[model samples]
Target: MQVSPVDDSLEQTELRGPRARTRKLMLDTAIALMQKGQTPSISDVAEAAQVSRATAYRYFPSQAALVHAVVDAGLGPILEWHSDSNDAEVRVQDLLKTSMPRILEFEATFKAALKLSLEQWAERQAGTFGDEPPFKRGHRVEMLQKAIAPLKHTLTEFQFQRLAKSLSLVYGLELLLVLKDMWGLEFEETQDIAAWTAGALVRTAIAEAGV
Candidate 1:
């Protein structure tokens, strides 16, 4: 029998054994702290997870990396969401309806991520930010574009992008921050308003496009 060379790259990419468990422990600890309204640092997570600071640093070198990982884990479902409906409006509504609860559940963690992003921005503006990796956001852009994909043929490129941009305002952490925090609305009310606004935007776009 002829033997083929084994691919080491796959093994390298997969976290297994103790390393995987340690990384997951840090992530879980960070999530628990963030959910309790605390923006934990790597050291904080290390102490909480009962791992050494050095070990935690090996997994996440900076606070940005830590928060980014935590956010990714928290929003995993939302990030991986897809809709089967062909109607753009239906897709948009389904996304809002499905994602709102999860968004609310991780509201504190997302807010912490947002705070870190703003802090990084301010530091950059003041010329204090060095080579630290920035905590990047904007997942909603792609999600909105995908949700409205069915309308691509009916609308122009500009119309499609504009509708997506408008819908972005009603989704994500900002929506919860505004509707819940500023307006003091409950989760159900916030979701209802978001769904309505998303539906209205889709209808308006289609109407104006004459489709």
Candidate 2:
């Protein structure tokens, strides 16, 4: 009988189940600790997760590596949002409606991750640290451009920049917090607002361009 290479590899990984589960537990526990603006000591995370210090250290060699894991965990959903839709506008609207709430629900978690990374970045800049910052602003801008490409025909160069800035700003963390916390707007409602807002911005830009 012939076994597929992929399936063979999967079987080997599955056979190492207990060790894999322990690693996942360590990572999850570490992320929970980091979300609270506290980094986990190796012993602390291992004890809390009911794993061993050796196990935790095997997965995350340093505090920076563990912090990077937490940052990736928090941004996982948004990273997956890139594959949601083919059209840029639909993708943005869908992301706004769906991922926004998930992001907001753990806004403090994301904020903590960002703060940790930024502090590390500053330290590196001052030649006191060795780790690189998590995530790049360029990735976000490219994603934004993908979402706005469909509306480009409706905007001039300057107007497109204005529209892009408005969309990014209006749909930011602050506005999201106000809408969800103060106005009590539901996730679905936010999706509607995002779609309508994008459409309005496109129309306005087109009109202004005399197109």
Candidate 3:
């Protein structure tokens, strides 16, 4: 039997026995392949990552799984950006700005994944009357609740509700799709627009509450 060079090289990397390293290698290859206008099929990814097809499949069973991994992996930097800001206002801006650049940075995998997610969400809404969506149920509500934490001290009960509603409405996948696909904006510019939009929304919400 011919020992595939890709499989052999990966076995050597596996000798160190750090699972995360291997996973990272696979994900990086997937992203790179996707970036080059390649569809990132399993065999292609396996070959690029220098891993056996079996090993690659062990980490990601399907194309969806591979795509999701790439998307989730790409989110790491944005998540860190949000976490490091630690300021609700700044974090909010960072999150919004990330929508465009972040997606563009991982355009292929993200575009593919986003399309699938949208389709699934639409299907669920039609079939179940909005019982489930791919983006965790109540994610917007939860994010809105967090975004306004700083202003809660100055807000009345009604004002708080308005703030939450505004937060939930201003951000999320719709904005991402619009900036990435519709407007043809680049990463930095998308972030700038998102930050401006979010900041303006926040101000409006605050004023509406008379705070």
Instruction: Mark the regions of model 3 whose C-alpha exceeds 4 Å error after superposition.
Output: 1-21, 37-44, 47-50, 62-64, 82-91, 97-100, 119-147, 152-176, 179-181, 184-189
Candidate 1 runs further than 4 Å off: 1-16
The prediction achieving the highest TM-score against the true structure is 1
Q: For residues 1-211, write the lDDT of model 2, one tens digit per residue.
A: 1225668777689658887777778888877876676756668788989877787889877766676666667767665555445455566676566566666666766666566667777877888976433433323454456666765766677777777777775464556556666789986676577678866775676678786
TM-score of 3: 0.60
Q: How much is the lDDT of residue 182 in candidate 2?
A: 78
lDDT of 3 by residue, 1-211 (tens): 1224667667787766777688879988988876665656678899998999999888887766787667667655553443354345665665566544565566666556666566667777688534322432234465556655677777787777776776655565555567756888665665677678778877776676675
Clashes of each: 0, 0, 2
Local distance difference test, each candidate: 0.90, 0.66, 0.65
- Show the colliding residue pairs in model 2: none
Clashing pairs for model 3 are 97-191, 101-187
Local distance difference test, candidate 3:
0.65
Q: Give the TM-score of candidate 1.
A: 0.90
**Candidate 1 lDDT for residue 132:** 81
- Each candidate structure's TM-score, on Cα atoms with residue i matched to residue i, is 0.90, 0.62, 0.60
